[model samples]
Target: MPTTPLLSKYPEFGRARVYLFGLTAGCVTGVDFVASSMIGIAGAHIQGGVNAAPEEYLWAITVYAAAAVVANLVLGRIGTRITFRRYVLLSLLVFCTGALLCASANNISELVLARAVQGLGGGGLFAAARIIAQLVSEPNERLPIFVGFGLGSFTLTALAPWVSAELALSLGWRAIFLVQALVTVPLFAMVLTLFPRRREAPTTAQMGTLGWPAALAFGFGALLLLHGIEDFRLARIGLSGGETLALIVGAGLLAFALHWLHRHPDPWLDLRRLGSRRYLVGLGFYSLYYLISGGWNYLMPQFLQGGLGFNFQTTGMVLSLAGVVGLVGVMAHTFNFRRVFRRRRVIVIGFAVFAVAAALMSISAMPGASIAVLMPPMMLQSLTTALIMVQVASMTYLDFEPEDFVHAYQLKNIMREIATALGTGMTSQWLQTDRAIARNDLVGRINTFDLQTLAPELPRTSEVLARLSLQIDQQATLIACDHLFITLAGICIAAAGVVLYQRALA
Candidate 1:
């Protein structure tokens, strides 16, 4: 069937049209923020309330991210066949239903399953929103729409932790899902009514090229990779059996999957686009940006709530400032600083600032440090996130032809999902290992036999010992957080140097 002009179906470009476009942007951006950030805010609840171990808690994030990676790659092509409107509506239904399932989940396993379901819909929302943006705005006029989307998305993300904290505290974590379900209902109605209807039937070629095999292979490979990481972490710490076998198995599977994708005539993802040097470098920077940002977001909540003894509301408020700063940074892009600086320069500056922010965060991880000490670094990190995210994305797609734009978007989304999962997983693994080491070192220093030592001052009662043990655990966690931040800072600084060196070589 012939393609329909999807853009022509909407009302004229005016206030009403802008409002609809804005709503679609908000929905797409909001779902991702809420889904990604909630894992951090609710990390404690999921671990303690659900009795899940640290590694197990990671599944809540990994499963969702992995599902999203697959969905983003597959759904775009599927949209071409089913029509954007029908595909979006179906996705919304799936999203809402998943939220309901999440709200009713009684265990971690159920919650993880529901999250996967939700990710499928969330991925569609992201792709559909981009499609709508493409259809509604001319290329020249699209920048403002993107800025507006960034502002709205970050604003929603900024408020999400506070809202999630309030709900989790007042009504329990399940309320977060309930609220998501309720909010999506009206959005669903709006989408159904306002979105353009499909007029064209899919061609035989479109119907036959679903790429399910590639998507399945990709997802399974990602899962195995994460599972292998988990096993490695456990084995290194002597917490479980060695993961060499799992690692080998996962590498083999991933290799097989890549080979399959390369051989497929119409692959879900066009790997050929990665051949561009600019695209590859930008892709590298983008992945690193998410690696740092995602890990920090996940780790910060644990530090504040678990290590520093902050209440949920207080932690939410503190972290929410980053969102506010992020909004400001997004707005800063409107000034067209790119006119004065090369994209490479802007990227290097962003990463440099990120490194500084990470260093500040490391210093703030000391025991008994005030919340005030953490605020500046957090805000700076958020600012740099907005800067790097927008610029790197623009640079990545800057040279692509119109035909390659879709593939570029797909590849970016896939990298983003994988990067986020790796960030959260790696940070969690590092924290778990570092904390164990710190705790052991602290315990070893206690020297109960030495009457002159600090341990002799404490009473020998079980209550006293328990309290002292808790204090030690808290301090150990703080030290571990410090180590993680310093490592992240080193990574950012090194990345900045690499970017600069690449510019020189170019």
Candidate 2:
């Protein structure tokens, strides 16, 4: 690759450079939010349009997540090897292509494949944005940019449902992808103009140590594990034969991958680094945070739309309040709170807030619950999520050497994707099982004799029975949601204990 002379020059945080950098960060993060938030709304359209089964819609997310996890690691390294500017531009082009494909997709399988491509590109955007931030700004100057990035991302995430719903209502779900494809054009132009191209060629040794084999193995292992979890969840109670076999194979592949990492001189991931107790503890806290937050993100939309009988527009409006509050929270932390509070203390406080919010959410899952009942928990959870994310990212990298920062970044991104998938999978499994139990219990109370006794008023008609059945299902779902929220509260409390224990040991 020809090197641009501009590549070696660092910006001195000029107004124009800062504005462009912020725009780039916002654009990158916005892509992620748009993709993630679309899943809750677009899944229905994809299912109906493609005639897909309920379980099959999950592939739209799972395949994307798996692809993104692998791409995040691989592309992060590739960017270093090739040059961040070229790699990001290529990724943007690929993302646009994927979005176009998604817009044109006529079936579920095509959509899933397109999403995988999109995820690959999306992962690069995420990795490259951070790399650019590191390259252009001094350490002290980077914090505000990151704060802005978080606000942009969270705002998009909160508003995505509404944007998507309106697009789908007015034009169609395909419009969402079309819009994504169109928006990337200006972003592509900005990257070409603003981002500096690489000047130096990567060393032969650097190129040789790319670890393609380990990367492939790890990616496959992760995909299999995630697929197995999805399979287990869809099976309702116990793992099906296929799910069991898939899990076993996935575990075996992961073990093999670990062994390869241990033995390889230049492994893709530095498994040896796990020996650091601080790193391990940091990962534990990070995973726990994602487990709770991911589950909340996945389940809340359904709870609002299904349990509370809110339409997509109403649900989006209600959820958008969290984003508003979260932006405020991020600003507060960035400007004032972070200066006063230590990272560990901030994290612990965030976890406590999350636990309380989760408990409140559990209590708010009743039949006649109003949007007012949901607001406090939603606001608190969003605020705490912002607090935790910023602190965790800071704390996790505090001990990492410069050379190890890439590895740590890759590890964190991979774990984040995996944790999110697991969170959604576990919540789905719990909801299914709990709903079944609740439904059975509810049904058990109503017998033929009870129906006969109520026939005078209820008429025992099929319409009445159908309505009764729908109510039962809704009630069961609400109870199941409550149970999931309470479980998350417990998890948050346990995570707090983990944080405190690690602090004590330190």
Candidate 3:
């Protein structure tokens, strides 16, 4: 809340240009994160706008997310080739262009293409900002920047969703882009004026042209794998022949990309620099964290609205209130107890909280649960996200030296995109599959003759039958939701164990 903490340690508090720059970069990153979350949460509204099928809406989200992941390849290697000034200006151009196109899209195809272009631009901004911060600041001087950046970024990341939801639902899906515009435009202007135009001599350490082959394989391979998983049917064999082929091809390409990166002296993504069990463990947790968060981000609405029969207005209010609660709790944790627990302990505690929240949801997420009963888990989940997020970002790189920052940073960003996209997709796929199973299972228990004897419905009309079917659908869906939450609880508990296993942190 106070600006004083950021400037207190800086000698040049009179100017504080670096502090401002770091804060701006943090805002840019926040905007990007907000955009990613919005795609998942707002997919239904956006789908209606473009008349896209559920899968097509998913494809639209994936194209943007996939392109964002692809941006990592260039971000890691193109550091010296691209000037900071040029990168900022060019990226903002593409980013804003994509936003405009998204706002005006007439169909799903046009929207996906625009999102891809925008993702490439939005994706680079994060890695690029972190790179510049590392390049410009000394280790001793970096804490304030990190703190300020984290607070500013995570603050926006927490609240912007509520804000975006208000705008998109009240105005239209197009109104969501206004959030991007507000952040990116100011960032662009700041860079244009504040950043020095003089091009410094490039450093020669491990610089090279963009590795197109490696980038394509790594990014596209990931996209393919995600597509196969997201689109695969869950009945019977769980996948058709084409889906099976997609899964195999995608896995092969990813394996090949990893092999190539290991062998190549100057890989595009430089994942080899980060070859350690600790780092890998951290990456796995990071992916899982985002997946859980994103999956819930997609699922909570279904549980509340579709299952419990809440109106849209009530659901939105509860969600927005939950966001506010999360934001406040995040502030408290960030300020008062940020150092009270070690990163590993904090992570364990956070996931434990996640387990608690998910368990609560599972038990209480019944057909007629009250908003008051549902509100606690929603708020607690939000708190878990902020608490865990603060830990993972720093813990992942705590062991790496300064030189390895770029590679590690880019990889983590890549994981964030991939994880969130896959989280939403996989959760959606599971919901449908589980709902169908739940329907079949519920139907098996229902005796038509017993129902007829019990109620006789006062009539044998088509309307009565349809209403009975609808009730069954709602009850079945709620059963599926209960299963989903229990599974999430199990994952949270297991993740707590994984955090405890990291001896490096211990």
Leading candidate by lDDT: 3
Cα lDDT of candidate 2 equals 0.73
Ranking by lDDT: 3, 1, 2
Candidate 3 structure, TM-score to reference? 0.88
lDDT per residue as tens, model 1, 1-506: 75433234343445455556565666655777677777777778656666777777778788877778778777768777777667777877787888888888878898889888988877656666676566555665665466656666777788888888888899987888888777777777867765545556767765547667667767767776775564356426443335566566667767877887788887666788667788887888888898888888888987887678788998898888778888788767755644635667777888888889889988787677787788888888888865678788766766776546667777888788888878887888888888889999988887656423646677778987787788888888899898888988999899888988765212
Which pairs of residues collide in model 3?
none
User: Candidate 3 — which residues are off by over 4 angstroms?
Assistant: 1-19, 178-183, 194-199, 333-338, 443-469
Report the error of model 1 at residue 47, Å: 2.2
For model 2, how does the per-residue alpha-carbon lDDT over 47-138 read when each residue is reduced to its tens digit? 67667666676777777778777787686568767787887788888888988988888988998899888888876576567766666555
lDDT of 3 at 220: 78
lDDT of 1: 0.75
Per-prediction CA RMSD (Å):
4.1, 4.1, 3.6
Which ten-residue region of model 3 has the weakest summed lDDT? 5-14
lDDT for 461 in candidate 3 is 76
Candidate 1 accuracy as TM-score: 0.90
